[model samples]
Target: MNDKVLIVGAGAIGGFYGGLLAKAGADVSVVCRSDYDVAKHYGYRIDSYALGNWQLMPNQVLRHVSEYQGQPDYLILCTKVTADIDRVTLIRDAVAPCTTIVLIQNGVEIERELQQAFPDNLLVSGLAFICCNRNAPGEISHLAYGKLILGNLSGRQEPKTQYLRDLFLGAGIECVISEDIVASRWQKCVWNAPFNPLSVLSGGLATQAILQNQENFVRRVMREVCSIADACGHPLPADIVENHIALTRDMPPYKTSMLLDFERGHTMETEAILGNAVRAAQRQSVDCPCLESLYVLMQLLELQIRSSSLLN
Candidate 1:
């Protein structure tokens, strides 16, 4: 029997990955908001640079969680982590007791809340290293790399995690299971801490442009993140910084998800990506001046966005 999967926040990340699971023969359903009409009518159209073009017709297209037909084996949360969104509340109604909750979101130290909320359910933390975006309603463009790292937050090598990995692999997607997913989050943040906010602060610049103009600054921020991770007892790889810089240099010129949210006037993951890391630094007595500065600037930008929204 195919595993039942329900995708919450079917945006770029959710749509792309959920579509892949569908391709792997899972009974994939989506709770769509912005693209509800289009998805309900035509399903999702995915164009991938590596995998090629395809269409994903979800087993169910729902406007809300309560409308889902049955208990899903997996519930994947791919929403942007922001102050304005209460993720647990959004999906509480449909989360069956037996469901494995998977969060494929950005940020360090974001798993605790869900763990607390669903203490009995298995919680998996996941990260997607991909350059994907929704060009229009129900249309996703997979511009570059797409690899997923998943692991149980409890540090156990859960069978479900392996099963999910096998599912992705079956669809020709690279999926790695990690014993320490938290450290992986910090490692990814090494790149996100700099490029994401810098893209916004630079008045809309792509990753390559920001790195080209201010490579030194980018490295400094990444180092600060590494320091915090080490202090928090999740030491990253020794050459993580250089690896990230090299990867960015070779990546296609792309606007980050944060910058894209800013462009669309959507809530950005300022707190999730930068603020949480800064707080972790403070708690561990780690000196992260560069990371702290980025946190403050993003806060101000978020405030400005809120203010503009109120007036307009």
Candidate 2:
């Protein structure tokens, strides 16, 4: 039987991955809100780097997770982890006892919420290291890199985890199963903690621009993240900081997801990406002055946006 994969929130990351899974012969379905009409009629138009540009119709398209039919082998939660929505509540209805829930999102200290909600369900933590965007409804633009790293949040390598890995590999996607996925989460944070917020705080500048102007600032934040990770027993590579700077330098001029969110007048992921890291630091008695400042700025900006919307 083909793997029945149900994607919640078919945005850039969701569309790109779910579309590829369909192309790889998995039974992929998506629950889309705003792009329902566009995707259902025209299918997903994906411009990918590794799989080439292609369009394919998922097995089904429903507006909400409650409408999902049958027991999905995997439920990939692709929604943005923001203050407005409860991530656990969004996909709780669609989950079954044996189902595996994969969190393809960015943030630290997120797995606890899912594990607590569905203690029996297999929990997979995923991090996407790609520069992609949803240009329009039913559209995705994959600029550079399309790699995914996954690890079981429960610390067990079940057969399902291996199956998911093999599935992505079959799709020509580079997928890695980490020995310590929590450490991988922290490693990704090193890159995210700096560039994501910097992009938003720098008046919507792209990653390249921020690196050019404030390389030291970026490194400092990354260093603090690594230190905190070490304290948390997820020590990263010593050269990881420089590696990110080099990667950003070579990548095409691109706006980060957080920056894009701010640009679209949506709530940015301040708490998940920045706030959580700072909190972890506080718990460890480690100082993260730079991340704290960015968290404060992003929080203030979000309040300003909410206030502006209320007045208008």
Candidate 3:
């Protein structure tokens, strides 16, 4: 097995994958900022109720991209959606000629941006089904859902993609190579569109925000997102709203990344989540009132947060 896996953006998703791959005996090198010391000291930890595990250390860890002596077999980019687009470029030159870039971020358009730079490298889109958060510098709490869906841009299964799937499956992670990755990505977006923003706005767990009996806000937000996806030629199922409602209900009390950023006083990824859908809908001449309202409301909320921070 190709042992070298470089996981960029050592955040929740990256750490989870790195930790699991490391436990599976892959030589995992993580690229992060100054927080590398904490990860190095504690190794990487994964806490899960569904997976019935806690904090497995990786085989290896590193701070800088330059510390990687040779090219990597796979580059797992798990940076935040709102991060600079140029960070991927720094690592693009470090990969082997046939290296696969598996993006495990939230937004749908990150693969497109990456493809423009490394056109020849195999750019894969992946959807993460876990509620992972960076509790502290080195600690990560993976509440539930450790399944992964991976596919190529053409949505075709090739030898390379299969190998990657096998690697993850061997590590005891549920890995699915789907022919409908676009739909899957959009499906995850449907799940995130409401829960992420609602958590940010209402300041609560995603399950709490969506599963509460009184608030139809969650359904309304997802309805608009589904409509927008349909308009952009994806046409997600109508029950997507209900599925998310149930999925969140089954999960434990957990805060979404959006709310975490809100509490930490960081900017929320409104454009990447809701704005991308709205832009696609407009391009395809579809109406998305709910998404629009959410976008506007978030922008206002962000502005208020900024103002309050400035005053303080």
- Please give, for residues 222-304, the per-residue lDDT of candidate 3 as tens digits: 77777766766677777888878887777676687788878876666777787787787778787778778777888898778
Model 1, position 164, has a per-residue lDDT of 90
Best candidate, TM-score: 1
Model 2 worst lDDT run, 10 consecutive residues: 153-162
Q: TM-score for each prediction?
A: 0.97, 0.96, 0.88
> What lDDT would candidate 3 get against the real structure?
0.75
lDDT per residue for candidate 1 within 20-81, as digits (tens), equals 99999999999989999999989999999999999999989998899999999999999989
The TM-score ranking, best first, is 1, 2, 3
Q: How far is candidate 3 from the true structure (C-alpha RMSD, Å)?
A: 2.6
* Model 2, span 285-307: residue lDDT tens: 99989888988888888888878
TM-score of model 1 relative to the true fold? 0.97
Stretches of candidate 3 above 4 Å error? Answer: 50-60, 83-85, 203-206, 209-215, 307-312
Higher-ranked by TM-score: 1 or 2: 1
Which candidate would rank higher by lDDT, 1 or 3?
Answer: 1
List candidate 2 segments past 4 Å from native.
Answer: none
Per-model C-alpha lDDT, please? 0.92, 0.89, 0.75
